[model samples]
Target: MEPEQQPNNSVVVVMVPLTAQSHLNKLLQFAKIISSRGVPVYYMGSTMHNRQAKDRVHGWDPSTISNIHFHDCQLQLPQVITPHHDLYFSKMFPLHLLPILIQLREPLSSLLRSLSATARRVVVVHDSLMSFAAEEASLISNVEAYYCFHCVSVFALLYLQWEAFGKPIDQGLQGGDIIPRDLPRVSFEGCFPEDFSEYAAQNIQWSMLDVGNIYNSCYAIEGRFLDLMAQHQSDKMLWAIGPTNPVAFDSSAGVHHKCLEWLDKQPQSSVVYVSFGTTTSLSDAQIATDGLDICNDEVIKQRFIWVLRDATDGLDICNDEVIKAQLPNGFEERTKRVGMIVREWAPQLQILAHSSTGGFLSHCGWNSCMESLSMGVPIAAWPMHSDQPRNTMLVTEVLKVGLVVLKSLI
Candidate 1:
C-alpha cells in the first residue's frame, strides 16, 4: 500500500461517506470511476468501515488500481447499540451513529489539512449527513467540498422547500412532516423522526458552504426534481452522476452463481426478485402476510426468488427454526418446486440484470433503485424507513416504473 501522502502539485479527490454499508458502497464506486479517469482518489473513513466497503464491493477491486487509496481516520467508536426490529430504522439512528458523527470532525479536519498540503487542488466529496466534514473542508483554502446526497433529489426538494409547502420551520411538525399537497401524500416518517428533525435542520446550513451537490441519479430519473432544486438553489452547481455500480457483473470477482443459476432456469421475464435492503427486515406478522400471498394459487405457480433476512433484530443470528415458525404451515413445501428462499446475501445486480427477472420487490433504497432501473427491471416498491418512502415516491409517482406495495409496514 502507498503512503497517505501522494506526490505534490497534482489534483486529488477525497471521498467521505457516512460510513454505513449503503453509503460507503456508493462512494467507493464513485471513487473507482474517478480513479479510472486518471484522478487520484482517497476514500476516507474508519478502518472497519473502509474494510467492510472494500471487501463487499462488487464489480471492481480497488487494490489493483494505483491511484485509488484508502485513508483511515483513526477514531475510537463507542460500543454500538443493536437496533430493535419493532422500531423503524430512523428511530435508532441517534443511538447507533451519533457517537461516531460527534467524534469525526477532529480527525477529518486534520486529514483534510494533510492532504491539502500535498495536492495543488483538493476536491472533497462528503455525504450530506456528514456536513461537519464539509464544514471542515471549507476552512482549507485549497480544498473544495461538495455534498453527495444519499437520497433522491425529490426527497431533498420536499425538505428544502418545506416553507414553500406552507409548513414553517419554526412551528415544527406534529407527528412528522408530509409532502406538499400537490404531490402524492407521502410522509417523511420513514427516514425522519420528529425529534431528529431539528438536528437535521441545523446541519443543512453547513451544506450551503459546499461548492455544489451531487446525486446518484440521472436527469431522466429525476429531471423535474433536479431542475426544481437547481432553481431553488441557483447559487450552487448540481451534478447528476449516478448508477455508479458496475453496469455489468464481473464474474472474476467470484460472483454468487446460485441466484443466477436459478434465474437461468425460469422463463424470460417470469420471475419476481424479492429483497429488502440489508438493515430492513420483516416481523413475524409480516412474514405471515407474505405466506398468505404465496398460498394464492395464481401467485404460487410463478417462479420467485426471495432473500429472507432470518435475523430477528438485524443481528447475525440465522435461526432456521425462527424462520420456519414465522411462515404459514407447509409454506416451504408447497412452493419448493417453484420458489427459492435465500437465507443469506444474494447477488443483487446479477439478479436484476438477468433475462428472467421481470420485477423487483424492493425497499427502494437508492442503490437498489438505481441498479434495478439500469437493468430495465421494474419494481414492486415496499419501503421500510429513512428516505425509502420518498425514494418509493420517486419510483412510483414520478418515474412510473414501479408501484407502492404498501404505505406502512406497521
Candidate 2:
C-alpha cells in the first residue's frame, strides 16, 4: 500500500531497502533526522529482521522521535532479490530469466500504482540496486526522484565506467565523440587487456548522459543527478536528501555501554575499529587471490579489531574459534601483547567516536566513512569490493582525509 497524505505534510519520503541491516539502518536514520526538522516522515517497510535483532536496532517506541511515524508496508520483492544468497547473487546474467522477468512485472506494476495514486508529488530517495526500480517508478509516476545510499567516487565510477560499462580513454570512441584523450583512465587490477565483453566496448553517446548510473557520494558532481531530476521544479518544494542510515543517538548509552566495557579493559587510544559493510564478504580466495594479499603484508604495531566475515552459506563465519583457526602462523601470538578484540558485532559509532579510539581500518563503506569523518578520526582505507575501492580513492586523492593502500578498481 502507498502512504496516505496529510494536508499538513510538506514533504513525503519513500524508502526502499537494499537487502540487509546496514542499508536499512542508514535509510531509517536519515528519515528520522528529516522528520525531526518538523517535516512529517512516514516509513513504509514490513516486519524485517529476526525478532530479536529488530527489537534491538529499532525499538521505535514513539518516544524515540517526536515526529516520525513508522508504518508496516509489506512490499513483496522480485525473485532475484528474494533474500536467499544463491537466488540473489548467483550470476550476472541468466538463461531462464523469462519466468523471473514475468514474476517481476507484478511487483513492478504494483510499485508504480501505489506511487501514482498516493505519492502524487513524491520525492523518491533510493539505494544502489533499488535505483533501477525507483527510477522506473518515478519515470512512470512523473515525480521527482534521487539516487542515494552509496555512490562511489569519480575515480571509482570512472574505473567501473571504463571497465564494466565503457572502455579506457586510450581505446578512444568507436562510435561517438570521446571524453578527451588527456584524462587518465583508472587502472583495474582485476580486469584483463582482452577482457572486453560485447557490451563493454559498445558506445554510449552524450545525448544518453542522463541515462548514466547515479552515485550517492563522489569526488566530483555532488547532487548532479538529483539536480537534473529537479530541473523543472521552480515552484515545487521537492528535493532528495540522502540515503542515510543513522545510529540512534540516545542508544549511544547502550552502544557506549558495550563499548566502554571493552575499552575499560583495554588501553586508551589502542583499539582499532574494523568492520566490512553488509553483503561485502572476504573470501579466502578474495584474501589470497586479491585484496587481503596487499593488506596482509602491512606492518601492524598496535592493538586491533579485525572484522573478517566469510561468505559461506550466508552466515557470518568469523567466530572467535574460526578467526583464530584461519589466521596465519604467529599472527595471534605476536599480537598477544597488543591485544585484538574479535567480535562479530561491535558498537561501530561508539567505537569510532570514542576518545580512546585512534584510527579506523575500513572497506570505505559510506556510512562508516561518514561516521568516522564526523567524529574527526583518521582512516586506514582498505576498500574490499565494488564502489568501496572507488570511495577510498576520493578519500585519499581528493579529500586527503584518509590513506588508501592500493587502487584496486572493481
User: How well does each candidate superpose onto the true structure, as a TM-score?
Assistant: 0.85, 0.62
Worst 10 residues of 1 by lDDT: 311-320
Give the per-residue lDDT of model 1 (tens digit) for 1-410: 23377678888988878766678888998888899899998888777678777776776677889898898766676543443444544433443555666677787777778878888888888887887767888889888655655544455455545643666533334433333344554335435566556656767877778878888878777776666667656888888888788887654454656878888788999898888776565665776675347433356586788887642222233223443224667777778777788876677888888889899988887889999999999999887766677777777876789998776631
Off by more than 4 A, model 1: 1-3, 78-95, 163-182, 189-191, 250-254, 291-299, 310-330
Global CA lDDT computed for model 2: 0.47
Error of 1 at 60 (Å): 2.1
* Candidate 2 local lDDT, residue 37: 74
lDDT of 2 by residue, 271-302 (tens): 76666655444544444444333333245455
Best by the lDDT measure: 1
Q: What C-alpha lDDT does candidate 1 achieve relative to the native structure?
A: 0.71
